[model samples]
Target: MFQNQHTFHIPVMGTGHSIDTPIRVAHLGIHSVISVVDDLLCEKIRKHYCSEFDLAYKNIPRSAVDGRAERIKAYLETVHEIVTRKFQEIKELPLFEGNEKDRYFNLLPGSNPLKSAYQFIEHLSDREMRERLIEDLNNKMRPGSIDVNIMAKVDALGTDKDDQPLSSEYSDASAALRGYANSSLSSSLVLSAGFNPRLYSYISDFKDFYRDTSGEIKKKVILKVSDFRSALIQGKFLAKKGIEVAEFRIESGLNCGGHAFASDGSLLPVLLEEFREKRDQLRETFLPMVQSFYEAQGWEYPEVSDEQQSPRITVQGGIGTNGEMERLLTEYGMDATGWGSPFLLVPEATCVDDFTSQLLANAAEKDLYLSGVSPLGVPFNNIRGSGSAIHTEELIKKGKPGSKCPKGFLVSNTEFTENPICTASAEYQILKINSIDESADTEEEKERQKNKVMEKTCLCTNLGTGSLIRLGIMKPTYGRQAICPGPNIAWFNREYSLDEMVNHIYGRGESLVPEERPHMFAKELVMYVDYISELSLLTDPGDAEWKKLVRMQKNLEKGMDLCMEIAESEAYEGENLESLRLTVEKQRMRLADIFQNNLVL
Candidate 1:
């Protein structure tokens, strides 16, 4: 069983999105995740909280103590203080007293008073004892002993020159990893486009650092993967490097917020089922491979108990209802379910401004779409009415197509010059727009190409600044805020308090979510169908396109079959089941029709 009272986790929102989100929610005794992409912000948060917690920065190095290390230390200290204080308060409560137990026993007159009193005292004492031991251990351990987790993106790890050591000034995967590894912070690295050998090498360095300093590897790494294949590949890659993946986090391809990386046509249910079936096989294969690497390296392989050998599998993306949440945990056997987008509505936990929060509340399905706004060239979940999008439009009208590129986190492209420039940079956009060969295509085609070049936004600053802007702590550089909310947000029509959101997650009370929203599975299916429709519009379809289409069609068919199976299951019954079945059937029929029409062509 999990240590936290809450069964679900809050997924990493944005560098600015949920900066202090974990701190706000950790007090509630729930394990939450915070993104460590912005070192400066991390430092600021640390300084602010450290002052609040009255914790001194004596243990950390003078230089690092003011930065990421300090931030992590402060966060951990704050969490510990909060949890310990809460525990102490609970232990002192009247319910734990002997007299209180006897009074409760007397209230139930038919029950044996002695037996009820004994049972109550024994249960209460056992619970208190366990909690006390846990608290003691946590206090004794390092800063990362708290339940809050950190998230690092493997791909977004700052783009520094190959020869230079990774800089913490920019948000890079290696820098974040190295920072946490060097500190007492534990976190998961999200791998989107498969394994990066460069990132693995950095992780190897991290292990070496821990080995040198702590005599044992101190860093516990979790791999956040979109699919099972990515998980296996990344797991094997880590095992080869003699590193253990603490968990395998499976996220829905299109249903997730942030940079939307669709897994061909793989559905979440199918992916989860595949992972459930092959988890043991994966662990069996991984253990020996990892053990061999450690032996060959002349390094000690960390001893993992049988219970800890296999990585825990968790799922995220578009999970709305309490029923859906329970099914994922109980039926699918998921270790945890991630409730992300809905938390955006909870201002106490997440950093959503009144304007953006209202925008999210009023958002419809069409308002939240997968847009080509990310400079990283990934499909980003975008709000159509966002200030950032409007700013980009205004800039285009002024004949300026891109941002100032204040933060060069996404500056990877060097197509136009010797020095690499961000795709979303005004310089890159101007160059790209100017270079478009008008003579080779129609005016309409030229216009389309120009518009495509202008679509990239400076998300590095925009995404990170939403909360700060909303809080009125920072002024908005652009006229609007850019938010990456999943389709699930459309179901929640109003902002909710932290307790209300948590209560809703625990099935204790009704949340603000509307009843008409489709099941998570159905929503993802619809998203895939939308993606397929967009895919079909590609003017020059190549072998890759055909392969992608084939994969999508097959996955669609498989997903529909899974839906039918779920519909017939005891766990899923009622009007929602029929709706899902019909939706899947309709999508399947549409796929058949597309192929049928293609054959005629």
Candidate 2:
């Protein structure tokens, strides 16, 4: 367990605090995802319903192979038209009042304050404005399908010029207006098949825009693979190809409903085992094929990213309890875990937060509640996680008016003295049964209690932080879908339901929650735990190092608190939500600060 003190690049682009930034946060080393969209309809469905809705029932049957392509394309055209109309209505919002306009306005990147009315009205041509208007409309629309030929052409780059890549004014306009837009979208084809062709477009656009975006803001792209089989296949191909990608994520444990592959009775453990068993074979199979392709170019050795082999597996979706998680890690030797729905629902569960105890209590009283949607949903009610389907269904059921952000359930936050069935009793028992001191207790009982307490705390602390060693927070919503603040807050409201449950324990205001805190904190602590655990394996066991580390951590917390307080106080006079969150994060990562300061110890 030697500590590999290697310097890895942290992607700071597209992962900012605001929705205006790219919709990716955190990366599990080089093994990350490169998300591509089939179309942009996902955005519109989200805005109108506060969830995603598929209108395939209205489109022709998928079994109809003859005109499938045309039908799908027509569906996309309809989506574009619908989204355009919706946006046009938004333009007539001056007559309405309340927060609706703000939501729609915030949905797009360059809508507010007109980006200088003089520049907007003066320089922008009528055609550019029309395209901009359409871009705004298209922002809400999701793609019905993506062209695979386009991906081949784009991924090939200089490798193939005979296969010309198609460009669209829509994508160009989107890029121009939003600073960046995706090349493809998550459409029916990508949902049904693996590897949307638009991924190539995204890669190319990102590469091209990186030059321009670097000067503006770093953007992030969260790649979603609905099917693991497809993801693995596409991943192998990408690795074999010469592409400088950041990570490869294996998203699992989601209830994808009836639409996606993983959810269509595709056993999780079986799929995982199959991939684990065949990964090397797949790699081997692809390596020679790529080599032969390169050999044809008279290149003795063409270097692919696969040659260097920088692929980190990111475990996302739904991983059950700590025991289940431990088993997955020990079984697969997983590189990292992306706590998708679980992290979204119970962010602090990764760290065994106070709310975690409450969730355990609720689970004991009631059957475990999991999200209905795969990738996004979980089966844990107190955790407040949901899958894409559930969310979309909820939106569809609730209708457009119901699409607004849902409010956190109002629960008292003060400490509990009574033996509440859900939490108080559990905490008391946990503290009592796990006590460290044995004085005045029956000898046998005292000894057991002391051991239990120590073991439980240690395990909880370890499990809490250990989970974060490799984690990434992926915003399920992106682009025009995120333009409106309504859906943004709404998405978080659903995503961070567990936080709401935890806030009840703290008794603070509802609006004070940090959007990224629970997830980010879990990630940072996990890194700290892994680092320490690895070090302990290599070095002799002693309290000197551990105690020193703890002491250093306490000191770092003080400094972080001071810095956070100053920053918070300066920004919005400490009243703003973002400003206050900085304070909480300081306390969360205080452990890392200590370990870094006393590295030699």
Candidate 3:
């Protein structure tokens, strides 16, 4: 019942985590998203393998790499040419005949195309064979089968600034959108991070440019949101600009990898229900606005089929089991489910070092936590006791706080000068330490702030360098690798092949997930409770603090209620209902304790 053969997508890992992730997964006829924040990393991917499937690139606006826009555009063009040329050669092969040719042309419906493709070229080493096969695909294949798409992660709340001259570009949201807009590629473009009116204007520019060239907006716009409100907000914003969002991608706030933006206690199931209930209202609200915009612009509105008019609802974050995937797609009416952190364990699909992969496979629940490690001041999902953490602590011990500030993607602090500097930079940290008013604050308070500053690691380099170091392509400069696997990863205790991982998603084999971990919904509730507990420690709570507590409390209760409903539902019968119930009750108690002990007094 799937329109496209791919019913799953791999979310963008880190700078290097999923650099060439798409190349590997695409061989399985699965769509994968890659981060283009590091243009250097993009170049590395192009230099390595040639592939004959679509690769999605996630463009972060705060990226500070040199010639970032041009470099990305060039990389896209280079890969496109490589893939196109390879396809042409494959068409001329003698063995590629009749139905076999058709099979190669249409690679999605069989037992993983990647597996078969590799077996077909078994004479060459695994690495060499993949490279050769990618470089020799048949040219007569359907157009757009092998292509690249762009994803823009706009920081709705302006990007962080750095003080170094030309060291960091404030925001490349517009630049990235414009580059892809000007490109000849017809792959889809996704606008992630929340809705930004200014970014929408850039999207408008892309529409105008594309219309001028192709007489229409051929590329589809996808909005990545965490909840229904966000989806509606983004959809309405794009509708005002005469754009219809092709899809609404929903992610779990705390359950996700990378920077965690915990929704105020709202559970994934609840959010999905809201969308399903109001699915018609969303389209009704959007269609008229888009039609009006199109009419005002003197352009004929593009006709969309019944299915295309309504945005597809997809969910990601903490999805561990095939059962969970099925429930999400069937019960929630979700179009597709994203398999992210678990893919990190599959070395074939992600750019993780052997050491880091082993660490991830063996990690416990406590190893993954939300930390203030991101220079962006966001709550980043971090691996505890990582090399980056050790390096940060060592720097503090040596009286040196902050990293060297190379590749300053996170440079957005300006506490020291007119030019913004990175909070994680050694120069800024030293200045900040000297400026601290020791007498004004208590010793404990002063030490707390000092430690926080010292703990900021250079994720810009560490995240991307992990894979490079693992492959012996580059040496670690600032520290060892820093990984950002979601809490769901704790349940997966071993490295898996791409075939095995895909099988796990489709329920083709025994479950790969360990049973000890809490259900995905309950795990999220526990995270919210933990966040509330952390917030309770504030000595002088403000009005905003109280409101945040209330929000968290309300959401946690909502989530707990939903978990109970799931437990009672027939779908989960005999599936460790006792464990699920215990986990939910434990989180419920934790939430209650936060309100009674911390807020009540």
- Measured by lDDT, the strongest candidate is 3
lDDT of 1 by residue, 166-240 (tens): 454333555555555555434344444446667666777655322332233344556678778888877888787
lDDT (tens digit, per residue) of candidate 3 on 1-601: 1134556788778778876664454433456665666666665555444332444444434244434566566566655565445444544554434443333433442354543553465445577755557456432133222222333443312233453333122255555565555556555565665566766766776553222322344666766788888888878978888777767878888889988887777888789888878878888889889779878988776554667677777889988876777788778889888889999999877888876888898899889999998887778998887877887888788887788987665656777776567788999888887777444888888888888887888887778778777656776553468889898888888999876887677766687876555677777777877887887777334577778778767876876787788877765311444555788888788777767775457
Error of 1 at 434 (Å): 0.5
Candidate 1, poorest ten consecutive residues by summed lDDT = 140-149
lDDT for position 432 in model 2: 47
Q: For residues 141-169, write the lDDT of model 2, one tens digit per residue.
A: 22111111111211211111353433432
Q: What clash pairs does model 1 have? A: 157-172, 157-173, 158-171, 158-172, 387-480
What is each predicted model's overall lDDT from 0 to 1?
0.68, 0.30, 0.68
TM-score-better candidate, 1 vs 2: 1
Question: Runs in model 1 with CA error above 4 Å?
Answer: 1-5, 44-171, 186-193, 207-218, 297-304, 437-439, 476-479, 539-542, 572-575, 598-601
